[model samples]
Target: MSSTRVGRGGRAAMVAAALVVAAGCSDGTPTGSGTSVPTSAPTAGGSVPGGAGAVKLTVDSTVATGIEVPWGLAFLPDSTALVAERDSGKIKRVSGGQVSEVGTVDGVESSSEGGLLGLAVDPGYPGKPYIYAYYSGGDDNRIARITYRDGKLSEQQVILEGIPAAAIHNGGRLRFGPDGFLYAGTGDGSDRPTSQDDNSLGGKILRITTDGKAAPGNPDGRVWISKGHRNVQGLAFDGDQLYAAEFGQNTWDELNAITPGTNYGWPAAEGISQLDGMTDPIAQWRTADASPSGIAFAKGHVFMASLRGERLWAIPVAGGKRTGEPQAFFTNQYGRLRTVEAAPDGSLWLTTSNTDGRGDSRDGDDRILHVTLGS
Candidate 1:
């Protein structure tokens, strides 16, 4: 790592070069994230918080027949679910207890860690009729658009190209902010210093328009939004607050509040810090416990998917600070947890990642787990 890192754009070429040497491998089934219903609704078994003490887990393997190395997931406006399988490059739709292959994406660069990674519905483009995707293509991270209507893909449009890619730090999570802008987390691709450089898109959380260009009113007139990140895979917004789960180099993974143009200190700092000009992390855990991936806000808590820790974390966020200790569930049951979302009905939807050439998975290992916390 350089003492003073080069700008983000300048070092992206290094990422492209690194991925070429390693190729071949990999791999969410988001089961929920719905609208507001009153808490008094009736359940078939009565409302239970679904915690370890209150309830037990029931994993479903019937739907696993169609998902091959599942990666990311999204929900349609009509309430149908779309899931991406990284190795298969196929997108599957689930509705009324049936999972169908809607379509397949081409040109996915399936290296050790590069492939179709993130899928997010356009919050503002809901009326425009397209879903967005983030994946590695030919060893570079890219964002594209697919017309996903009536549970099928009709048109495919490559929106933006030339994001840095490597076996690590591709920053593959995508989500829409409360402001209706697309936010993406990119990894430093082993060059940790690039995270602090603004000119490149790697190692940063990018705020972009629907067209994959940087949103207007940005502090710098480029795709770089917030610099100094290693491999941020989890993103969520609470009311108006922005939060992210970031993977650290060799130390602690972090939970942070996303602020525009503020550096979070990548090579110089791993977790929280008192150093000037370096943003501090709100919460942190050892890398062995949490190589945290997707995160979402639900039922007054922040839900996270852990890849290394093999658990789902329920963190409470309030007033831009962590309220208390997080509750851990599904520990080592499914292998590696990757994504989580709080559905409109209050159930926390979770996705798994053990099949992504990592984790010690059991039979029916990498599967989505739906928990009904209130009963």
Candidate 2:
């Protein structure tokens, strides 16, 4: 194995009013940063936060269906997206509400939670015509680069490998940062000790170039930007600040404001421990209320997709800090939400994880949905 290092909204006015009242900030002002709320306070479909209150989601259409555990969703220069299947190792193209097979990633070994997980189109696409993937191989998890052209995939060039792999906690989510470098999230692989181990790549946020070497200016010339995470599957950027959603043990799930060279308390602190030298999540939820996987920033809010909680959470952010309480939407409406991505057309594309052996699969159990702001 090789090691590298680096480093929404809206709503009807009346409904928004109700939420502002419920939040006790009817004046439409934001609350404090790192605010923690009870999972029981804002029930599903409650008042949206002030920042997200003006925008409401309306499912416009189903873009694709019959996908076998679509885990990674990345958009091309043409606005069409490439979707990766976790279990099948296949990459599908979704455009104009039609789905077509692009290509399958080789050597993908699916287990409890590991498989082909994250996808990212080269920031300079068309010119680069390359796609990056994070997948679980037979012995370890790897990040590979593949060329796409004429609907075919060239042999994968493994850029990074040797991340620990386990049945449950192989963290896989990839995105090209605003800095033009690639970022990856890894889990502890159920080995709690690794979360705090600086030498281990597991349970760390890695920053690297497309070639998989540590990005320039990374702390200690290592690929890790931050460490001490359980299982991180959700990563989104609001301008320059990066936010991550991670799965917790039994007590809490976290939405942290990721900073380089920082240590996020994992095995030691589940939620708001206020421990010195450790960064706490800006917001957190009960484990049962939010096993958040994918998150996107749109409409002045961070939209988080919940798997175990079967809900979508909207957390209002202003100037890179949480301004209002996190609000839950469409609770149990879309079972096991996996990914939420903001589209070029100012809409959002969401995927369901019903067919992932966890949720109850409907006829169109696993599908990509097109959602837009409601009037």
Candidate 3:
């Protein structure tokens, strides 16, 4: 695939040639390496383009299966995707229909909602060959850099640390923005007061260099990009606009347009509130309807994966503002959708969280689904 960075409207052009093959799965056991098991054909779902002139999309097939709580996905230049298992602390690669364990992150303290969470391939890979991962340690949630070589991961280096970690609310989503800076979404570790603290790292979107220091353009001379976010788990960019998917406490889940130095009302406001000095969400959904997690931008729309809601949402955007009602796809078809990523091929890749403790596990408890959007 070309290295050209496609504009928001040109995202569909990045779709690679499709290679249809039989679906395969790994054994039920938890092995760092997964073996392929022949499974039923890929199940297809989606709708024709309609509201807001959204592109037609179809969940055409399953890529890999038997994954245990696949959380983060990062692709290689050649279209190979590296998946991080949230509780296993293992990194697995899915190429074509084959799945194999690359390696596991040492010292990952897996608990409720912790362990290996997010993974991002270095924007400068092959030459740099570094893979960044956000995982939970004994004391806190931290970011580490490791090398991927010969199907193995080694040379782990802690890049950043000290973010609070709780059994829940350990926000863990990492991505490299268009500006080439590493951005992380962190939780307040269930510490509501920390969300409003500027001096603390938790409950903020952190912008930093690959070396772990704060990014140059940060509002302060530290990692804080924005504050007062309760627990943001999804981060993506559409053109120059950054969007975050936040889990609400009791009322509403939000999709907010992020800006540096801005405060997103957390304990002060669960969802939309015309509170003074606080930015409100562009779109908000009832907590039961949207426990939004990983999100991706493609073809002029932001796709969010819902865990508790058990669906995927397509929100159309025009000029940085949502243009129409969000469309729900694959509701209850795939149990607990966890992450949705725009592949190098332009198609959206989604991971299921069926085996993630909270989900209703099936034969192939977890899997990766491929989605293609078109007119």
Q: Compared with the true structure, what per-residue lDDT tens digits does model 2 show for residues 1-375?
A: 344432101112312233333221111111223224634433323445455455576676888888889999999888999999999999999878778998889889997577999999998887888999999885678999999988788867888887876666778999889999999999876567778988778789999999898899999998789998878899999888899988876667889889899999988987778988899988887766777899998887888998877777888886667888887776777788999998998888889998887788999779988877542
Residue runs of model 3 more than 4 Å from their true location after superposition: 1-52
User: Which candidate leads the pack in lDDT?
Assistant: 2
User: Predictions ranked by lDDT, top down?
Assistant: 2, 3, 1
* lDDT string, candidate 3, 183-247, tens digits: 99998776667789776677899998888888998995768789888788999998778999988
For candidate 1, write residues 1-375 as lDDT tens digits. 011122335435565655542221111111112211112222222222422223322333333433556777777776667788877778888676567898887678776667888898877455777888888876467887888776678777777666677766677888887787888888876565567766667788888877777788777677766888877888888887889998765556789987887888877887876678988987876666667888987655677787767666666677568765565666666677777866555566677776777766567655666766641
Pairs in steric clash, model 3: 14-345, 15-345
- What lDDT score goes with residue 110 in model 2? 94
Worst lDDT 10-window in candidate 1: 24-33
Candidate 2: stretches off by over 4 Å:
1-47, 51-53
TM for every model, in the order presented, reads 0.83, 0.88, 0.87
Worst 10 residues of 2 by lDDT: 23-32
Model 2's alpha-carbon lDDT is 0.80
lDDT, each prediction? 0.69, 0.80, 0.78
